[model samples]
Target chain A: MAQGGGRVQRAAVIGCGTVGASWAALFLVHGLDVTATDPAEGAEERLRAFVEGARAQLAGFGLTGSGRLRFVPRVPEALDGAEFVQENAPETEALKRALLAEIDRLLPPQVLVASSTSALLRSAIVADCARPERVLVAHPFNPPHLVPLVEIVAGDAATAARAAAFYRGLGRRPVILRREMPGHIANRLASALYREAVNLVAEGVASVADIDAALCHGPGLRWAAMGPHMTYHLGGGAGGIAHYLAHLGPSQERRWASLGNPALTPEVQAAIVAGVAEEAAGLSVAELEARRDRALVGILKARETVAPDPAQDGTAEE
Target chain B: MAQGGGRVQRAAVIGCGTVGASWAALFLVHGLDVTATDPAEGAEERLRAFVEGARAQLAGFGLTGSGRLRFVPRVPEALDGAEFVQENAPETEALKRALLAEIDRLLPPQVLVASSTSALLRSAIVADCARPERVLVAHPFNPPHLVPLVEIVAGDAATAARAAAFYRGLGRRPVILRREMPGHIANRLASALYREAVNLVAEGVASVADIDAALCHGPGLRWAAMGPHMTYHLGGGAGGIAHYLAHLGPSQERRWASLGNPALTPEVQAAIVAGVAEEAAGLSVAELEARRDRALVGILKARETVAPDPAQDGTAEE
Candidate 1:
């Protein structure tokens, strides 16, 4: 199968934990042969198990590819014939730097190396690499095989464009950041929202269950349809965002001023823990995860029916 | 036709703008007689047109009621036989206070009055009313006929509970606030998220369209399935929120500290306006709205298939 201009037929997946396993599944489902490596005990077994589970979900999206997967005990073995590399080691500065340096030394200059680190800087992680220009951050939301978002941060626009095309070819929505921030784009947006959510819980304004319901039922539903900027554009009415900014910008600033900066004190943490337990009712984490995945599958199917024409928006372009 | 223990068979909707018209449509579809009034020119024509459009969407949800709608020129006429009142006047504190006082004077103490004001405090709005305890704020998300969330803020718990029961009877999710706050729960969370969204745009981290896509494709999808708290709970793995809080609290604080506090300056506003225009991709606001409603319908239908049993979580209870 052709992907990224038919240049990436084989891929190396380093550190086969959850993120790596998910990436491997995605690559395999796109018809790219995957050679995955991890140093942990029983890593291959766990990686295979995860991929098998993910394959079921991928099949729901009609993503069936004929690629084989091989597990290796070392990075060099996995990188032997790889055209692309995805690194998902645990987020330790020294460890990631060393691992990336090793991978950089072994691979050719043209092979794109992407990190799945959510907390560390790409510059710091790529410092020890021989060709840091080829190293980039291609962070995916958890369970990468299911979620379509892949945030790309690169040293140059050309490499970023190449990575975006590759991910887009594999049926992912890749957002390329012009510059790197602490949590990329989505996580930062999510953290901002969650901070206010936590503040509400701490202030005793509402229970955990009610707050969750308010979001999923209200703005959350709209968000699944469009982003904040576009939502406000509609909120602006016929005049659009310009009108909204002219009329409602002051009120937004007022709300922002009153936004809380709550500390995650012990009491607040306890309150949240108890609230989540109550919200979860009697369901275990596994049960909740299953529920979430089921709902996600349903939503993805629903979105497919009404997805915008990507051609008009340059969403599908290289 | 019973609502609020069969005490609210008839509802009076004052100020028939977009919010009021949506409320009127929701009430009518819930099998309540609706008497609506507005002083704006051609208000009746616009309200009827809006309701006609909403009725088609409500029918998709199987909410076909045998209620009747009446348009009255004066508030007293509308309130004459009203068992409940939903006020959607302009969000000026003085105007809302005066309107509530008039509504209070015309109605008996037992009849409940709910305001749809997104801004302004419940106490401030109900201050001039003779029976202030009976008045509360029941703020609905946009297009109240479609979205399910109705945030209720009252001076007392009994009033909030009563309002919640009424809304739940109408097939809406009602989150009752223990105390009133600016922007309520959903809007506050939205603003918190949007602030970062704006910050990203201002900082030139990514394009407006990509930022939006990142959200809807990533966290937004998860949000539709569950709230932020629940998302993080799942993120915590088997150990849950407690484990997450203990381990990830510092990183969260660091991100929060680094979170942008972007000013909606002239330049920032211009950049956002241009970005939204680009994101819309030549689509008009009305077209975007239709797209949003269509996607929302699809999502709601999909959610129905996997909706949790509300009985277990007390989600359907008063």
Candidate 2:
């Protein structure tokens, strides 16, 4: 709804689970009054703790949105005076449809509503809404506050453009999809890669630890700085993407042909679990999360040095 | 081959291409007396320049090995007193076979020879060698000195173990494959993902820039620290990888079913070229490479802060 900083003062975060809490913290850090609603027990306490945890990370990136956060138990009250709403409810189709429809009916037509659905389609989620044009899928990766991607799939061009601008203002990379697709773009690519990764483990081509190391040390390093297309473009030497398709296309096709589609049988599942155990080497999830977040902060800062924030760069061309 | 440090003092680098030059620099940085041989014109000057350029990156990693670098014009002369030989010749079977055979005849039995072939198989490449056991594939990602991954695919256990130990001593993550397949492990996984990325571009689902952003901001960051298996393990919540498989396996399969197999048509190629031009925004290939290397150095340093180097950890368990 709001183009720049002055117009959008208040934002509502529906469903204060892990994803919702992250959204709430991010909104507050972006200097928006975040009214977060979650019906779960202890949701308020958890949200507070999550926000406090995210404060250090935001500070690491030198972000201080300085907005107020208010906890509410009812959705209607949360959306009373909010200009933007980010819904992170359960993944059930019926639940998301009903919840989105209720939000659409209660919120004003001008206010935009976004659902953080990783797998669900935006069309299906907003099918029952009174004004579906304003409702879209604004899926973020896990740990929404840290990760910069926000996949925006809108029913109308104006909604997508506005949402893109809003996210850009917050220093997030919002990818607008030309059409609605399941799992959006990132998950589909990840699923494709993971399928082969599973197949390799099941086929005894490589160990789980080795497979993971292969990625993290090899292409994953490149992927951190650039995507598959850009990496290939670089791979083409000075000739760029066209040279790659012409010369290495056949080799890629051969590799694709040999790509595995292994069944995730009981045996495969056991192998993966055992492999992860060895890889973890007694490190708890919390320990791993801290390590991951530290690395993320460093990488985000590194990227910023190379490609400064669009808001700061004054080159906000989508 | 010798296990640990003192015994393996001399190393030989065959071929003076980009991969060969990087291998030369890495070996030299690990304190190996490197004798690099390449017959091409101006090979010595090019090799010296490449090594000088990599010096800053190696220094950033706190590496300073006092090893002498000698340039030789003939392969036999380079291998005369070398303990290890890393071959980086062209991918032609006839050239690799003849070159490897010559090295096998010249070097002693204890000397280990590794090929830097990415797409070609070790089995096929070493089919004509006198002693294939000592010859294996030690594929490195592009710019081998920066990226730490080296996919070791050896025919026998001892050869693979020795190669792993050598790479480990050089501060590299060498993953020993259980079985050799096309593109090995990393490239196969990359190819699987890239196929879908190409398909998305062909289908008009998203732009090239957004596709890259989705990955770099999302899974790519996680990938830089941990592999897919570990990321999914965390995604599984407190249940770890086991819980994830039981609940989310079906969803992954569904996503897999929808993965595309698009042809690398000319139109698709043109679109990528145009999109990359826009994404590049007037940055040259050399400029992008420098930015990538700088970011990589920062990420590598950040990772070291949390997970200390395995050499320092003294628990080199692959």
Candidate 3:
């Protein structure tokens, strides 16, 4: 397969929505020839605009791909000469299944096909593909071009490793799941955190703005530097996680037991909507997105300067 | 109350453990005269060392307070002439209750006493104080001199607002809980996130290191910029959060329902301890901490440059 790659020279993005467009931009910025196709009428314009906008951010990472980008109206045409395929169609199972089947029919078995499905399992989605072994899930976080996490779930270890290497080559931190799970790793963690965040707002424990402030200013800052495990390990002081678990495990259990599971009743949802509006104050969604993206860029730059990822530095065990 | 504050000139730190020392460093760096006391042997020496190490980080934010730090062996001496009190006694309820009562006795009713307890409720701890109304919880995240969050809980809105103003004056983001809850805001969210993180390890979905990488690289970066509510609001596209909830709320609920509540069995604890050891590789806890602090300093600097806290600027509604 394209698994025994030197470097993937050509990539096909088989849907030009935001995810696909971002993938296309990332591929282009990494100097890969990209052929992109989306059925929507204005897909080409939107894709081009996204790439244009993402170029400066990608350039900030010192990535300036010189490869050509071609837009095709059909998936089959885009798959021609493609060594890798990234399918980012709608989230509907039947649609993705049918799309993958068609892509499997058009492409050689050597080409790896990755679906950017955040919620679906690889086993469920790959059922229709004749070469299902080559198809896996490679979920990227939102604004995929910027955020460097790519969670990969594969049918086999080799495929997962190959995907990880490819993404790692592109300056992305690819976490390979030993087993496919809903929401994978990061999203599930995010979902867990968000549930509590929603609960806090639902219970009127704090304003949406204050809760957000608490996160960004508190654990969020630390999480940006390290993960929960590492943070706790550090919190354990000199004796480390062993010491922490020995002493603080009960408190952790108590806190976990007390965590809220609030349903998004209409009233709760309305409160959240209103609270978010108040938090946003005068800033529009676009303005907030822009601000978030800018802040993300600054953080990425800072993290790079302070502590480059050990995985990227070839020190971490796969 | 001393909180009728033009500016708080003197503060008492009622313990010299890590939390107390960090608070002392923060107060001293903000130009507040700090009188600190602790019962532990060599407490003064450790406190001085911590402050000396923290000074460099505080200076990065252009904070170099001219206030004097006095190390007293007794709480009465620490409280003498102190305008505000930050009690960081050990987490034992009985100990904190007695210490707080003593502090309350030593000071006038107007001198606000903020306890730095993470677990004990204000109602429980303040019961011993003659002026229970003036005592409140003002919890800071670890390494408080650096991280900008301070979660406050009080019997009344007036005290909460007063504490918020005081914390804000020190350039800390103080989130006031409308009602006291176990783990308060940030810790609850963190515990929620950590529970999922531990589950992933227990279930063997991914390595602890990879999960950490996924977080720091992805959502952690966005979170450092904005919180979950604002993040989803932006995720809703032009429709904002109302649209997001209307469309994605079901998916959120599904994920939350599927969230795991893993018990920290001995085996599970062993796995996490081992996983953290592997993630840490050869780096000692002190080395990891120093690395984390450096990254934090860099991130804090970057955040300051990109998006100064609106709360500090007096833009957001109290």
Poorest 10 consecutive residues by lDDT, candidate 1 chain B: B305-314
Report lDDT (Cα) of residue B183, candidate 2.
88
Candidate 3 lDDT over A192-222, as tens digits, reads: 9999999998899998888988999999988
Top model by TM-score, which number? Answer: 3
Worst 10 residues of 1 chain A by lDDT: A304-313
lDDT of 2 at A294: 81
Of the two candidates 1 and 2, the one with more favorable lDDT, higher being better, is 1
Residue B90's lDDT in candidate 2: 83
Clashes of 2: 1
Return whichever of 1 and 3 wins on TM-score.
3
Q: Residue A253's C-alpha lDDT in candidate 3? A: 93
Model 3 — TM-score against the truth? 0.96
DockQ-based CAPRI category assigned to the predicted complex of candidate 1: medium
Instruction: List, residue by residue over A1-318, the lDDT tens digit for candidate 2.
Output: 352434578999999987999888888888888999999999999999999999879987778878998998899999989988999998889999999999999987888899999989988889899999999999998888988899999998878988887777777788999998899999998899999999999989988888998999999887887888878877887887788889999888878888888888899999999988887878887787777778777777765222222343433323
> Which candidate should be chosen as best, given lDDT against the real structure?
1
Clashing residue pairs in candidate 2 are: A29-A65
lDDT of 1 by residue, A77-151 (tens): 999989889999999999999999999999888889999999888989999998999899999997788888999
Residue lDDT tens for model 3, B1-318: 264545679999998888999999998889999999888999989999999999878898899987899998888998999999999988999999999999999898888899999988999999889999889999999889888899999989888877888888887889889999988899999999999999999999988888888888888878888889888888788999999999999999999999999999999999989988888887898888888888888898887322334545542212
* CAPRI category for model 2: medium
